[model samples]
Target chain A: MENRVLEEWEIKEMLSRYGIRVPRGIVVESLPEKLELEFPVVLKVSDPRIIHKSDVGGVILNIKNYPDLKEKFMEMKRRFPDSKFLIESMERQGVEVIIGVIKDRTFGEAIMFGLGGIFTELYRDVSFRLIPIDEYDAREMIDEIKARKIFEGFRNIKANKDSVVDLLLKVSRLVTDMGGKIDQLDLNPVIVREDGAVVVDAKMVIIP
Target chain B: MFEHLLNPRSIAVIGASSDERKIGNVIVKNLIYFGYGGRIYPVNPKNEIIYGHKTYPSLDSIEDEIDISIITLPATMVPDAVESCVKKNVKYVIAIAGGFSETGERGAELERMILDKIRGTNTRVIGPNTVGIYVPRSNVSTALTLPERTALPGDGSIAFISQSGALGLLTMDTIAEFGTGISAFINLGNRIDLSENELIKYFEDDEKTRSIVLYIENFKNGRDFFNVAKETVMKKPIVVLKSGRTSEGARAASLHTGALASNDAVTDGALAQAGIIRAYSETELMDYGKVLAYQKPLYGDRIAIVTTAGGLGVITADYLVSTEKGVGMKLAVISDENKKRIRDTIVPFGSAENPIDLTADGSTEQYSRVLEILNSERNVDGIIVYALFQTAKVDETLIDVLEDNMKGKPMVVGILGSKMGKRMILEAEKRGIPAFPSMERTVKAIKVLYMRGRYLKRRYEDGEQGS
Candidate 1:
């Protein structure tokens, strides 16, 4: 079966269905008259073909007012004429970590947790476990990383470590339910704050 | 399940020869030399007697029921030989030949033929391209490797399972020098029937085996192996030295998770999650195995260093806390009361801090007293004793002190030097005390014990919650 990357909005909908917290967002073909969400929103071109949306200027962050959101949405619509636009709430900056799921050829479905953004590839500080992990396994994944000190109030950042553990178990259950149909799922830069954790961006590749 | 295979009462050596150079001859000689208590039937049509024993012309000719059969013929002739063993209702067959599935497709077809002959019967195959097994307690050694270099180190707790015959024999050959012995060693060449998983399950329940060590290049059935390993480790610690860690062995992946998931990284994580310790090299494999087998798991990472030389104590302390090579252990704190007790036994110049230094004038009596205090100390989780024999007063009597102190806390001795010192190290190992040549090795071995301890604590806590 051919693999396809799910669109940004589709991934958010899937995450919410699995009880994972994602930024409140809407996918619109055209700019609406007024915004229902709070000000300072994120505008992005929701196209499945775009794997690195920020690299191609498909994402515009921090629109302060309604006119700015409308202008940014129109600009993104023109840039990718066939694609829809996602307007999301700009999340508060917090501890950034990446959580991913991949169908390993030998061990089958496995989950990965690491320092998110460029650090995910730069330091390569990640830990993995075969899916259907327990609370202990999730906790170990968090502690195994070299940069694990980040969760324990690294510098100015302090994250709710328990929320990350909760996120891991929920994702494990989600991947376990999806089974062999899901090839890969990446929740990059999942902003883990003192209060809770949110998946700021999600990318999924499925066998269907 | 592998009673006949492990400790056979009677064995038939098919294609057994009188020539000293042949593998067949070596098999028969090893059995007799190792004092195998069972009956031995040498089967060869051309010879009436081989190795000073009456030989049978064929399996049908032997009146006694065979518990196990060793086929030392070439790969092409293995099927017919297995066919005879099956017709005779032999329980197990150890096919010691080189050519099989390891060669190519045609060889795999030949292997399948051998498998087909023993499909419904009681017979099980060990290898068509393997060295078979060695059980010291049963006095059975079927390895084709030379007896002199690959002499079996008499019975001990570690059960070693290797995928490569030569590597397995080499490790076995050197383990004796390290003062470690194997309860059993089975080489899983081509893995037609018995693989590491089966051997692991067998050793888990075996009273002789305390810990299991594996040298696997690639798993035969990875998922099944993982499942078995997950359950087995809760009972006993399992250590693996899996080769092919480089990126060259990695599969090209399109997704980020797959891209980051290199062969070694995934293996490292998977093994850890299952509570199986991974060793990067052969030395690490044996070192981890020996330590896990001999010592009880530490309760925490806090460690105490007892040494005759202050320099050795300092070096050990450095390694104990070294971020890169260390396993996150700290210099154990001693209460003032315990510190005064240690001080009263040692010389005037000796220091009584975390790395308790006994100075060059330290005697075996001092060591005995210090170790006794440390063993009773609540702050210390484990102890690394630098049993330097080069000192004036420290002599062979220190080995006795180490043995006596071995009961309460996990202690590893670091001793290295002339022939006399090496013998002392071996002596300690024979007594089930882990002793190494260098401070680095001693610290690394302690790391393995610490890892096992941490893993067991989590497993037990989870179990308690469940119940």
Candidate 2:
């Protein structure tokens, strides 16, 4: 396996190589002729340099078909001309999880995992452990998150426990392997589907 | 400014009067009282002799090298006095005068002038309205006021920085009373030059400072403070007591130091993000400082409470378990089943469940029995014992029991009773056990210990995963 700073596509490619599931998508620098996916697909600016796409109105979602996708793509292109766009099939129902690395000045690299997608910052319900976490440590991180109850099948929703745990361990391993080379890697919405999980969108800040 | 303030070889007190009531006189007396080994220079422009030492007219008249110049003069003449000391090449100047910055516009302007004069020079000023600095390892205290009578120079473990001069002095007095020594005590009054964050970064690598305690009313730069704190706390435990938590307190802090008290919730979140423990009160500040100064980090939340009184033990257990989502731990009140296992050696009446209530009539022997049983239990990660020495029957025995049983356990003790009971509590402290008179203090201490333990366990578990 290559150990270098990976861009958005490069990271997804590496994750796919590691047998981790990622949302099927295509990157386009311009508006596509016609959308290939079904309705309710996600369109996001796919520049690795842009960490928070939603903050800058760089994401458009739930387009029904080709007409809607073309209109949204044109609007996004008008706003961020230099940015590449990614269109992927959306995972409608799944628990959102975030996996990232924070370089703790004293202890060096620390991997953090918790409930994600907007609520992460609002609740700040995250747990941190040193990098290269194992399955047991990943399980402990899941338990420490404030939304742990939700992950335990709360509110008539059965959580995909095995997939979520596997995703956390894989993210931890990826961060440890990258070491100081990657400043931060955020998989904001790792959807925990009923039978499996998928990394829908992710970003990484590489050290210059 | 004199070089002796930071690296003092020889020091002298100008205007060092014999009178104990004046600031000048107090400086001279405390230096001798703290046992300074260097040459003593007591200069009073008026008196030819003071404190049994020949008084010189000024820094110019002093024949020897003056590394430090501590000026305690009237506000108007301070600038001129500083200039005289500058000519003498005094590298460190600790201006203990209070009129500047604290006495309104004119004083603030005077302070600016002082700063302007000191600029572009090797001389650094500690405070214009300050309480001096203390280096315990060298028996040096440049502050005008002395700490509490009980305080002695000890092996330094914690470095303290305070924005308030009076609070800094008060904290030193408190530390002295508690028999804890500090590596350094810095009072950043008005913060005309140095800042709390700079001191934090300085102490981050200092071998003498094991833990850092900060009493801050405001931050010069909140983001910078957060980043430095995040880095520092992971290496050394950082406990902070932000004084202006309430609106009223914020107003008071603003008037005191011109600090804009940020919203309490935001500050709390930011502090937590940096892993800095926010202490609610002065009592918690000292209590946590003491705990973090000594105890090892806890590994888990599971606690085994051993108390002579059932009520106190139950209260402690309830607190440990009762959060928003029911009880966090499965509290086992030392039951008869576990008691039976140790009954051959211990008394039959002792409860064997988690809160091992040895009964009110419990002696040190009973404490030994309960501790031994709890320590042997796999579920117990730490222990909190409430030892009440109400009568002579269990007083001596309790001390012996605690001394023997509390060898390696992460334990905290709460003692409840009158003045004599408080004395017994101090004796327990003397035997390497931190005993508090109030149950709340005991609980808070245990919680801090538990927090540290959790930090350690998290690191250990994560380290294993990383490996």
Model 1 TM-score, all chains together: 0.95
Q: After aligning candidate 1 to the native by TM-score, how far in Å is the CA of B165 from where it should be? A: 0.7
Summarize candidate 2's per-residue lDDT along A36-64 as a digit string, tens digits.
67678888887756756787888787877
lDDT of 1 at B238: 95
List the global CA lDDT of all models: 0.87, 0.70
Score residue B444 of candidate 1 by CA lDDT.
92
Best candidate per lDDT, number? 1
Q: Tell me, by TM-score, which candidate is best.
A: 1
True contacts kept of 1: 0.50
* Consecutive 10-residue window with the lowest summed lDDT within model 1 chain A: A67-76
List the pairs of residues colliding in candidate 1: none
RMSD of each: 2.1, 7.9
- Model 2 chain B weakest 10-residue run by lDDT: B252-261
